[model samples]
Target: MDSPVDNANAIVRRHRLSTRLWHWLNALLLYTLFTSGLGIFNAHPRLYWGQYGANFDHAWLELDRFPGWLTLPGHYSLALSRHWHLAAAPVFAFALLFYMLWSLTNRHIARDLAFRRDELAPRHVWQDIRNHARLRFPTGEAALHYNVLQKASYIGVIFVALPLIILTGLTMSPGMNAASPWLVDLFGGRQSARSIHFLTAFALVAFFLVHILMVLLAGPVNELRSMITGRYRLPKPRSRAVP
Candidate 1:
């Protein structure tokens, strides 16, 4: 007979409280960034490709009139876009910094959250994929914290996407860009940076869609509780399953 504490450990480790808070807060910040970004995009109303970008004649973007109830026009204000973006930047930065620092300090950056040696095995990956496809969940065996796919996605967003977005954002500003010509040099030029920023945003949106789908497939209530409470409820053991 195990005590309550023992049982708790066997089933689920209560997630670190910090993880829960940071996760939701980051979600909020990301939403703000996304909405304000749309406003900014609407202001420009065009997208360009290649080195030499958008001229007045090159209109690759389109916008619809705001609904009459909204009492707005066909366009968004550049000033308002700048204000919202700049205002939200610090909050977004702070949330990311805190999340990264906490993850590192907590020793949560382990093989369990990263890629596992065995995960690269074709057999194992195939088995897991089959289980997921069949709705036969792998609560414990699939990697309780994070599987290889999750780790790769998370790391990419943290390192690649976040940095690219921030730098390109700064590059768009005259004052910031003036102080740092290397920013332009690294990304090729201002228009290039803008293109990169837009592409990265699209990637993130795609990632979010996949993420939400996975969460739904994994059991939304359980996933939501785990994220919110920092604790996941483990499935009950079955007699036929070997330890």
Candidate 2:
């Protein structure tokens, strides 16, 4: 027999062990990739859409070089930046591949991240949007499953955005280009691929920022604890009045 306090505080296993490991590992790899990438970008702050681009050429997008504090190595070194970026690339790619395969095999994607038909309705989506805007999060058993918006975002990132980034990255690689000329053609050119890569990176960054903000708004300590450990404390259910 559990008291009200005990029941409210009861913990549930939310994430699997493999999912927890993958989450932290992905976080570390993404941090290294982003900082190192910025260091590389500092060397070339302009983006173009063709095979060749230089300081003399006009760029569709341009930004000032990022400061040392914002980059890996903490100094301007294109060579060092490339070294860091390349070193992290294989691990990140492999981890993503492994995670996707594991998730599919375990049916975690189907079980946890899949959206129901009703959730895809315009009315339902609008409701979810309004709920999120109002900071009205799911409680109790509902907390165990991701809301519709969360499912859509996660699916998009995992399926579309991640794969596009990887493909664009390979398109920018000289060795990869040599091996598969089709990649360059697919993206239009190296510079185009670079532009796409930058866009995708920023998209991921935006996602990360929103994710952190949501966690904070939802209860950072509880959210962080769930990811750090497998246990999550569900919000207590609200009582409803009967007529």
Candidate 3:
């Protein structure tokens, strides 16, 4: 076993090349998709739940158009927005698919992201939550692994949010509806899928904000270095006080 002193000083491989690649790529891709998506939404700020929706159709949720500053082109151009969104969407979806396959083959998912049986226990999860609330972070060897909360969020984004957003995006496509009618049926209808897509996109944005906050709280330099270079210095353990 490595000594604590040595462990604290050791520089270790924290992220895989694939993980870093996808992380940066998504940083760009998601930004484009999101901004452009907001622009597209500006054309119709209302959300509905049936096959058809338009100016006169009743909507389940409605909102004032997102501001120009918050959208792609920084102006109202649905054509340009759709162009940006369409171009980026395929790349983002395919990259996620490839990353999923690669992670599976590399056992990154099983080894890192998979939840342990013990981790799923209510007491264990509650403890993790409490620790996070208190801003307690792992140290030394434990810092090399994700806590339960981290694991859960990563798994949720990878498995649930990303795929659902992709399918919902496809469901909104008239061409896709012709090709895969089941996609629309899966989510109920085009409008329903659109609503889900909108909600899921915001969910991802929420995750990203929380993720950034965690990185900043944990130590931005170390966190950013690990993601960028795949090398991380283990955080030194807190010393026990003499009793």
Candidate 4:
């Protein structure tokens, strides 16, 4: 892998095939979880601000319309939601297990994804915010593989929100809840679990929005190609006139 400075080259060091598969599978599972979770909420059909137990008039969210087209005769929305949520849960769990094992053994996980010590520095984060705000992406040799901020956000979503969603979701089921009253208490209550689920949903969506923005800023062709082909193509070198 000669440096582009030393040789005119088009090299590829793209994502591994397994990594790409995991990425796509994770996207599908997330989508399934989101829609099914929404469907489950359709039963209760109400939302409130503040904690779930706290009495409040602020019913800030709801999906009032049962889209007539999707509504099937004799089909229970709640049951359907439960079916999808439960079905998708195992798949999502398996993916996480694979990811955890793969990353733990391969060291690439720690090196590539984990936030570095310097990344947490206030000055570094501030610079990232300013740069991202202005849409000034890194370029050429200075081009970051990924800025420190991206690493932190990804790690947070994986470690915090994902586990919280999984645990809180299970707390809603009576049988599971019976066995695990501790989980209910951990989240505050059954209603509180629902509330946390909603909050985590919003956070995931927010992360998705930011992720897309970063990709667009990073150069779509480069980023997308790497994800698909497993080999990123570097920019073509400018031709030098023969002396």
Candidate 5:
């Protein structure tokens, strides 16, 4: 397709239809999983390693139960929380798989998320960090491209964090353990898998918070409109003097 009105700084297509669909779907599913998972955790707010963890065991970490507002059902009920989590888990996993395949076929992963060699250089990476610290956001054409930091974070969340969480989650399940012993062995044991799952879940929560901050920092209206409508108005080009 031809470039949309460069001189006028037109509302160019920013996100693809598949991207928009997956983004909203993921938001809803993740919210459900997070809240319900919290409710489940309220039953046992402790983490341990190895094969077994009980009240008698020395938990590496222990905490009070999450507040009612932060959990699903707004009450302590492990069984109900498990029901909500189990129902959402398969759907979330399948949606991620579908999104990954679709992104690959569309070249979205390769073209947008892949890191270029130059971007990995220490000097370049530091410069991007400094720019972000200074709130020196990209404009015009530059805004359309994913910077090294953006690419790295997106790649980490999608390829590494999401997959790890899903696999570790399955490893903690008795049925999954029975059906695929190797999966359990891969994570060392059920207790270890449980610890990893809890950690990964919070890591995703951190990412979500930062993602929201960036959206607000970079103009939520523009960022959100781009995601929802697939169109983004290009910021005016920054003037520069050539030596």
Candidate 6:
């Protein structure tokens, strides 16, 4: 049997160097994209469906002017905001593409993020949700793997949300529309794509907020250290009573 000290000192590699690099880089790019996107949204705070929209058109969703503090550069500069947003777009897009390719080639997505068949059952999902609601986290060997909910959330963000956001963004680009009119048609029109992009941006923001909250709940030090050094110290397993 291992000594307590040995067990305490024991560490497991939880993340790869490339994964860590991409994670942090993506975090930075996302923050830039979100904030600057807000700045751009401030230029036109209304969302409309179909092809065209203007000051006189009927908008489906409209909001009061966003304060300076809520926007990038802390001021109204549509031109500057567009520059920041557009510049970050390609870098962000490429980073996501590289990460996806790496994940696929390494089988990380399949091994880690994919839900097992059993995990898809309603009972299992409900149990996981209950555990999470109770603030009960995995321990020991169980902590080595992500929970079903985590897997689902990660997969959704990686395979669905990010791709949708990227494509909708491309659809909104005039040059892209010129190059591929089919892209615009796929989304119904430029305005629809713009609305989708705005909604998806908020979805990402919601994910980020919940991610930070979970980290704090799960132990920020361990979470941060794992991402930084790829070493994670598993929690002690819960004891079971004999039947």
> Relative to the true structure, how large is the alpha-carbon lDDT of every model?
0.68, 0.89, 0.92, 0.71, 0.90, 0.87
* Candidate order by decreasing TM-score: 3, 5, 2, 6, 4, 1
RMSD of 6: 3.1
Question: Which candidate achieves the best lDDT against the true structure?
Answer: 3
Off by over 4 Å in 4: 1-9, 48-76, 141-144, 235-243
Give every collision pair in model 5.
none
Regions of model 6 farther than 4 Å from truth: 1-9, 239-243
Model 3, 1-243: lDDT tens per residue?
A: 133767885889899999999999999999999999999999989999888888799998989999888899798999999999999999999999999999999999999999999999999899989988998787888888788989989999999999999999999889989998989999989999999999999999999999999889888998899999999988876676844
**1-243 in candidate 6: lDDT tens per residue?**
122433543588999887899889889878888888889898899999999988899999999868888778689999888888899889988888999999999999989888889988999899999988898887765777788889978888988899899999999889999999998899899999999999999998899999999999888998899999998987765445734
**Each model's total of backbone clashes:** 1, 0, 0, 2, 0, 0
- lDDT of candidate 1? 0.68
Least accurate stretch of 10 residues (summed lDDT) in model 1? 65-74
In model 2, residue pairs whose N, Cα or C atoms come closer than 3 Å (at least 3 residues apart or on different chains), thus clashing, are none
Candidate 1 stretches with Cα past 4 Å from truth are: 1-11, 50-52, 57-75, 140-143, 237-243
Clash-forming residue pairs, model 3: none
- Indicate whether candidate 3 or candidate 4 has the larger lDDT: 3
Candidate 4's residue-wise lDDT over 41-122, tens digit each? 6666666533353324556565574453433222447787778778988788778778768877887567678777887789
lDDT of 3 at 99: 99
Q: Which ten-residue region of model 2 has the weakest summed lDDT?
A: 1-10
TM-score of 3: 0.96
Off by over 4 Å in 5: 1-8, 238-243
- Could you tell me the TM-score of candidate 2? 0.93
- Between candidates 3 and 6, the one scoring higher on TM-score is 3
